[model samples]
Target: MELTPEYYDKGEYIETDTGNKVSRKSVIHGSQNIILGGKTIIQTGTVVRGDLRRSGTAHAVVIAIGKYALLASRSVVRPPSKVYKSIFSYYPIKIGDFVHIGEGSIVEAAQIGSYVQIGKNCVIGRFAIIKDCTKILDNTVIAPNCIVPSFSVYGGSPGALIEELPECWSQVMEKNAKIYYSMFTPK
Candidate 1:
């Protein structure tokens, strides 16, 4: 998946006390401004741009990820960009726990709640607020500034609510995330 294999071999990554397995192959800028809660897997080819820091704030974390969040291969998780009062700026991207972003997805969301599963090759637009227990199918393109309600299933070019998520989705998502973390091994 195009990760820096040497880091895994050399064990250079700081394996956090919370069991976060971050691949060295992932392009993560501004490490100090990125917070990974625990048990988060940053897979190969994932690009998390924390260097696009918020304007005028040194302590602002560009990306704050919660526990058990999985960023799959080639996924790009960047802060949402915008032009504010004639100045271009990038806002922080907050991802909640148990959120699974699939391979090749691009997420520039304002917030992603817990137990959300974003399918492969999806494009989550800027300022999109995705709530808990939601599933976005493959190749879906969510529009900017849209709010995705909880317990919903969304898919399409401009993302539409297709159905309601099952009541037990939270448990299922959590279980899957845990399994993925447990099974991950560097080659």
Candidate 2:
């Protein structure tokens, strides 16, 4: 079920078992799909392109974001499509826990790690490996298939290594994941 409200103060999309939610100010165009086993929330002003493939049948985005994973407003997430490929099919995008996705960024065909913060207006290349506790500052490019060494701060034009990641990154992600699991229990 897709929700298109004109304007809402604080909008929430909840699944039977919890999934993706795009806020009221956000524009989601296509078949409404909610994920399960995890929680993913799209904040205000976000635009999710669901039917970009046009493959005769309905095309939906695969994967889910772990609970407490917040996707800031204006972020773009769509089904993975190869720029050039012999066979065209959909690839899924998976986001882990305690993850903070910055505003106005483009992410596709990537497996983001837990406790990862991706800066705004940056591009996460297709098929990238983002390890845990990595802080990718704003305006950086995560190259395709590039292995981001875990527990580091990466910043600069070509993504040069900055320093060791914050000591709290690991602890924070773990806590987020645990709290998320607790939501599944019955009251």
lDDT of each: 0.88, 0.65
Q: Cα miss at 187, model 2 (Å)?
A: 26
User: Which pairs clash inside model 1?
Assistant: 3-25, 4-25
Task: Estimate, for each residue in 1-187, the C-alpha lDDT of model 2 and write its tens digit.
Answer: 0122223243254333555444667676664442423465567777665555535655455655666665677887665567455766656667777777778877774588778878887777777778889888898877776778889888766676888976888786657544543343222
TM-scores for all candidates: the values are 0.90, 0.71
In model 2, which regions exceed 4 Å deviation? 1-8, 11-21, 29-39, 50-61, 83-85, 173-187
- List, residue by residue over 57-160, the lDDT tens digit for candidate 1: 56678899999998988999999989989988888889999999999999999999999999999999999999999999999999999999999999999999
Strongest candidate by TM-score? 1
Error of 1 at 148 (Å): 0.9
> In the order shown, what is each candidate's alpha-carbon RMSD?
3.9, 6.8
